[model samples]
Target chain A: MSEDFYIVVIAVLLPLTAGMLVAQRNPYHALVIRGIVGAVAALVYALFGAADVALTEALVGTMLSITLYAIAVRSSMSLRLGLLAAAPCDPDEPTPEEPPLAQPLLKALRRALSRHYLRLEIVPYASPEALQFALEKKEIHATCIAVTEALTPATAQSAASAPYHLSVRLPRLLEIVQNGVPPTLASVSLYRSRQMTTANLSDSPDARHNIWENQP
Target chain B: MNGILIAMTLALLIPIYEAWQDEDIWQTMLAFASIATKTSIMILVVSVLRDDWMIGLVGVLILSVGNASLMLLAHVLRRMNEL
Candidate 1:
């Protein structure tokens, strides 16, 4: 069975080549490639008439390891925070030193979060509504809006007195907000984000006939 | 059998080449899995030719559990990086 030998050799090399390609690109995706290697080994086992071994490899190597890897990847943290900016209603006020805003508080937060094992990425959303939409879509972990009765968009006139509304879904972040943001000047407001529903006909492109009928 | 064994032996070079070329831990794990799979299959073949299913069962065990433990180790290392 020289032809069988050739087939076995080909089976071994194919997955090895493919695994090398995928692993070289991203280690994250390599978890999937590892399963492929396992399946190939199972195929080889089956070819040699080791049926029990083949079944075990297929079940344990190809399936279980991949599932564990997927879960592990999901558990890792990559925080995306939203900062919504609103334009000041006044423009004629004389320029003084820039409003401190929440920069100092956020700096302290960065250090504190590092100690707690988290990465803080500040993403600026154009408007409060956009930020709100992103929060609802779960595109962002949390959103903060400035209630600065400001002189300019860059800095509030009285940053010390500037009140901010914070909305968050993550428990660790909620804990950070409770302890981190200056409570005297900052008012943290917690609100549940609205999840999108497939039952809404008005949300669909073809069905704009009625909006009130679908309210639930 | 000698020719078949040589083919499997040559398969070992792929991972050595891969490990030399890539520094990423996941890549290294993937290479190890690939190499383990190859070696396990070789063991299976040997056991089958010798008419001894016992050694083949051991090969099966490695084929099934080796990648999983390696993957678990990789995941732990990743979580450690986060912590």
Candidate 2:
């Protein structure tokens, strides 16, 4: 009788705690708490000589629910992107209130990927060589570097070409570049974060361009 | 029986307090697992006292499969976090 009483006490206490845990705001913890409650309920049934019930509870309640909960949590988070750009901002264009280093493509990313919480990190690479090395090593998600003119305003319109040429490494960014968004849209301050990468509308890219452009 | 009950109560309290205070994904899952284990044990005890094989069988099921889901979910969460 005493043993039975103790089992009963344990049974009650377990669910009570499970219930409390379930009440938490975090779904992750709640899912785990539900598993605990399920296990305890199964235990209570087994103590009462109902192995069949216990078996079903063990099979259904504890395992399946936790996995489902995990999938749900996994599906809900945002994507992470690494960008590197070095494009000259067209002085004639009106500047926006974004950080000084914000490139046109960066602004485009903020607009395009706004629905999901996009964690766009600007990885700094010293030269195009270093940038390419980082991208090859999978350090940066994508990279953009100045193709034609360096940051020398002294040689400005004199030896300048008619159109600007940029190159993009990642597929998702191709759409923003193809939209003909000029390199002039610069808001991100260099002092605000770090350096930048700019790759856009460059025609001389390799085979990777054809496949990624069509990925959609 | 009473001692077991006390132990279970303490077990429950830890999860409840931890869940309330900590927001970590790992700790939360662990707490839930602990609660599920204790509950299944209680069910097994109940099935024995009732002397009903059907009831006992239910306990068997829970003992066997109850924690599987939580484990699976934990694995998924861990993988997703890696991304």
Candidate 3:
């Protein structure tokens, strides 16, 4: 009876443990815990005579946890501080000369957009709702937003449905806006495409062999 | 703030319900719920302790990465177990 109960508990607990590890606040830490849990779970499965499940869980869980942790850390640390700077000279109170900090950030944003051939527009506003309203009204296509303002349901929902895309460039106000599509989705799609292309390019030779090897 | 809280709550509850029905799905859901809860907690904590903007931005990115990882892990695990 004790052995049967242990089997049931192991079967139930392994996944729950994995889930808890993944949900940890620090993903880097989470991955470490996940690896430890995976190893322990594998041992339990082996003891229960579920060697197949044990082997797969051990290998896949460790690989995935580490990969995910690396990716998360890379993205978080890679955020550019220049992007989060303040918006240029207020349209309402145009100073005769542009601030030194504003010119380069603005130019950098312009160049980034030009690479995608997106038209850039800037609007002066004190409130995010006003900007979102402008976006809904089709006054702008995309803009950089502060993360605090961006997370609002109104802002997030408006962004999801807005004609213009919204993005947050850390440490600056040089939010880039284009004409129709939101930049967020466009950027994500672009990154995914690049990843796929790179994967295909690297795997072509191996793929050919597998195809040939599998052919009867 | 209120709105975000509500959204996070609803997002978490879906997986908790799914977990109740299927042991396999429950495991997966448990993982998801754990991550979502942690993210929400982090966002709330950061909002209180530091700049709301910085933490919020980081929170969203973390949430996305966490969800993506969970989904990928579940799929891979499922396939491997099949063999």
Candidate 2 per-residue lDDT, tens place, A1-216, comes to 765576656556555756566566656566666666666666665555555665666676666656766676556433233322333333454432222343555666556544333334444433444444444455555544332433334323422442333334455555544443444542111111223333421322341221112322
Candidate number with greatest lDDT: 1
Comparing chain B with the reference, what is the TM-score for each candidate? 0.87, 0.78, 0.52
Per-residue lDDT for A1-105 in model 3, tens only?
642453444355457656756665534345444643554454355444454564455456644655565455433322221112244333455332322334444
In terms of docking quality, how is candidate 3 classified?
incorrect
> What ranking emerges by lDDT with the best candidate at the front?
1, 2, 3
Lowest summed lDDT across 10 adjacent residues in model 1 chain A is found at A206-215
Query: Model 2, stretches more than 4 Å misplaced?
Result: A1-22, A41-57, A80-216, B1-7
Q: Is the docking of candidate 1 incorrect, acceptable, medium or high quality?
A: incorrect
Better of 1 and 3 by TM-score: 1
lDDT digits (tens) for residues B1-83 of candidate 3: 34444454455445444443333533644644463445335344434544545445444444454455555555544542332
Poorest lDDT segment (10 consecutive residues) of candidate 3 chain A: A187-196
What is the C-alpha DockQ of each candidate? Answer: 0.07, 0.47, 0.03
* Full-model lDDT for every candidate: 0.59, 0.51, 0.43
